[model samples]
Target: MTTPSRYVRSKTAALITFPFSGGQPRKGVELGPEALLRAELPKQLEQLGWGVQLDRSIDWDSINNLLTSDADINSLKNPRSVSKASEELANAIEKHARAGELPITLGGDHSLGTGSMIGLNRVYPDVATIWVDAHADINTAKTTPSGNLHGCPVSFALGLDGSYVEPFKSWLPNPPIASPNRVVFIGLRDVDEGERKILKEQNIKVFSMHHIDKYGIGKVVEMALDYINNGTSRRDRPIHLSFDVDALDPSVAPSTGTPVRGGLSFREGHYICEAIHETGSVVGMDLVEVNPLLESEAAAQTIAVGCSLIRSTLGKLSRLISGETLLD
Candidate 1:
């Protein structure tokens, strides 16, 4: 039998979509939110018995009343815009989370994860986080070589070194939104030298492709869930899954800006979501970085795969229950 979510009071999913991509210097990534919507994301969730609360009431066009000018601070691009947008996204997520509705945020970039983690933490203060991506995304202001805020959202979420600096601190809560002990990463293959030291110094948990190859995806996920849950039970704490499309192999999902080679296969990616669904502890999820403009030829394929992954995360679709798949 499938395990029903303990957090949702009703079968309602807050389809929080944002098109702000000020975090990175990519024009196509901002179109991700609309791409997923055009793919009938709301209807797909409704088929799984969810109400699909599509709330676009927020005036995200103004960047949440930001005084942002295309200025860079501390080598960061669009710091004010990203901070204000993150604050707005965080507030929307917190509202839905407080209403006992599942918040499935469709993001403009992986930087949206900064909002996801911060907002969910407001409700579930002890929420466990699962970051799925090819990159570690733990780069700090001092560590970031490109100055793209997309690569530094994890640092912002954790309040790592240089995270408490200007613009972000004005809205961001005092760091450590979710405890470092409750955060974990999977599918990591490309990690910067600075990010490597940060991960090691902070004692964060990570399962790279090397680990996946050595112990298999199943064991890696099991260990990740256990660590986040403090080894008590996989369902012991609320979970927030931040999925970057780059985690999947370039062949499986090639529409992303930073496509890493030899990433998760179609089945491997779905397995992570399905496993989390089985726990019934996932309260929030963010599907980010599906840049359709980058790969026009394969954009349709990437969108289809992204939608399928979200479905697997939301319900018992790709896995067996009592010796039978849901479709069977």
Candidate 2:
């Protein structure tokens, strides 16, 4: 019998349902977890030989109550709410990840990336991260045009320019969780001007749609993994995939808030998860920004894809395609 890898069990996914949308201006992203659950995402993973544990210890009401003040600190909306909840989320994810369980956090927004990575990095300090989104989501307080906290998670995780402020500064650690070298971004097409400058200055790795059109999904994902591992074997490091549904073209996942036109096809999106599962080093993942309040057919389509992608990450796609056995 093969032993399970160190990073995760053939482990249970501690399904953390974050019914939060305070990170941005949207109202329905907080409904993401319920939509995925109603679609039976947990049962689907069980069929793939993974256990599912719903994390109910988090008091989401209290977390939301903290947002009563509409005051923006340093131009960041819902500052206290996002900061306090993220700190709580960090604790929750750290508990599961440290126990060697894969924490598949259903996000309220990409801002949860700030908390999720902090949790995963606390366990695997050298963890590598792959961010799949239409926007770089790296704008700091100074660079953000809309002042949404969701757009600023990446900078907060890296301690980049304009991220050093209260609330975040109080809990977000020194030296931050993500080192610039260990991060990579894919499916980016809507990146802002300020964000482009940071990507250049920080020398981050990015595989935009232009690159994907040039090199194909397989090669782009391969290059992303190679770059994150610094050209070493990927098995030695832990990985966290933060996927925003907007990375899929609007047609593929039309229910998302920031749908982009040119995005990954269904096969291409699933293929990325397959590649990550093949590494067997994924410790945590986040599926964020799914709003089920949109068109009925479109919402259903987006939810189905979200469920499918989550299963792929848990090794279902690889088990089928490569004839690799999963679980005992």
Candidate 3:
């Protein structure tokens, strides 16, 4: 039995997997959640003393049923099904939050952010999110050139679709999880022309590669943490970290569904997570778009190491020796 404490307590971390591949044009991102598990992520976290709850499978059949009903020529994949799965995911995350447990979701794709963010919002209501990725995922169905749902999750979360009817409407009744001012994007480099316009007009805080190059990652992370944690004296709202694996340099994490050039170095990525851990307000996190099929054996090993770095974000590390400091 675990008891809650003041600063820290025995925490529960759930590894929730949704194997839906329809979000992206690519097929293998659905394998991401399982691939992380096969790499022994649970055991690693267990070594850090978190009580691990593994929701190995979600009902993809239920998602299929909803999608089939809402299928369209323009929207080839089922919006109804995707929304349904998101709702279920939301419910699960809400349950974990209410229990005072930390939830760490694995990727089915970036589209799953729709569900994960919704779930976090339901629990914390005033929650803020940190979006770390190579591209700005803010395209609507009309705006998306590829018609891939993965590219449109941020738009969906923000409720920006022109065809806001039926199943799609149920996904997000409100417009966006956090206000544009509240959200911060880091490590962006490969944005579409329209997305660049949307990001600029909305005044969303974007720390692009150029910004990082000028300001340094340490300063960028400091600004992000302060922005999210500001003005909360008593009970701070939760912070949801949506980390697209593609935010990392392709050389470091090449197994993603979309590999972009010029992303965060391995140390930079780990430092972001480590700094978030320092804040102690992170409630939920998602590591998305890791496509093992696109990887070689060496690439898979690299991703597995990267996943370990995420564990560090949740305060997972080897037990300290008697004389060793945490900083050591």
Candidate 4:
């Protein structure tokens, strides 16, 4: 018999759900992925002529339970379980990327970044990550006061120590997925004191609200693009974008578990996503930490619309129709 084709056509986008919510002290983020899906995200993309493949069978609950049981009572909520869930998520995302599909991940929480980045790194060793959030998320276990793993994913993904125990070593890779230079943080306003030291010490590029205020979104994005795309030999180095809903102002997305004030405006957030899409190298993305329980149904609907708008920045609903701009 003839061998089956090794490469399936990748015209469809893969929606991978990660529903674990143990990253922070809250419990509602576990429902984020499902809520976004129910918001008719697939139909929206379908309207733009892209096929949608929903992969929602992830065992987020089991992962959450495992982490909660193994967690240190005082330090963090669920360290081991978060790491375990990340490992599983990494495997799935890696599989999809290797198959040449665009992997769009729905987060259980921001900690999912550890697993998601690991998976992307396995497929594209030289990949870079663009972290869009209100907090730096670079704090390690030694620096974190809240013990929220969500604030430590960047550290963990870079192989820095956090709340993880000895038994969870295998869940994280040795060198992690990204280097300090390869990662860029944008839209930050609320930064912990320890996180500030680590960021300055590592010389990690951070464009905080002050920077945005000085340079404007367009200029900031231009600088960010240059920073992330600099010195790469390959024409297309794989890009993984980690988007926390809290990156937007609480006025825009109040349903996030950790809403920070003085964040990016809706247009600013969309501009970031659009600029990244313009790079033509984005292969994976994550929408994280949206909590429906924190808001009314109407508010959740608004947040859902914002999610759709962000997805559009990735060309989710964009079409190549003939049109003239106002300038034209």
Number of the top candidate by lDDT?
2
| Residue 184 shift from truth in candidate 2, angstroms | 0.2
Sort by TM-score, top down from the best: 2, 1, 4, 3
Per-model tally of clashing residue pairs = 0, 0, 3, 2
> Highest TM-score: which candidate?
2
* Reference-based TM-score of each model: 0.94, 0.95, 0.88, 0.89
| Span of ten consecutive residues with least summed lDDT in model 2 | 1-10
lDDT of 2: 0.86
- lDDT (Cα, tens digit) per residue for candidate 3, span 1-328: 2322222243878778877777766777778888888888887777666689887556777776656565554753556666677777888887777777777788878888877877888777777778999988887777777766777777777666453545667657555554744678899999988788777777678889888888999998877766666633332545788898889898888787778898899888887877677666677888888887774774585558557666767664323332222422
lDDT at residue 76 of model 2 (Cα atoms): 85
Candidate 1 residue lDDT tens string, 240-300: 9999999999999999888989899888899999988878888999999999797576888
- For model 4, how does the per-residue alpha-carbon lDDT over 218-327 read when each residue is reduced to its tens digit? 98877877777674433255578889988888888888877779989878887887767656677788988888777586458545755665455446423332221111
**Model 4 residue 274 lDDT score:** 70
lDDT (0 to 1) per candidate: 0.83, 0.86, 0.73, 0.75
Q: Identify the superior model by lDDT, candidate 1 or candidate 4.
A: 1
- lDDT score at residue 197, model 2, on the 0-100 scale: 99
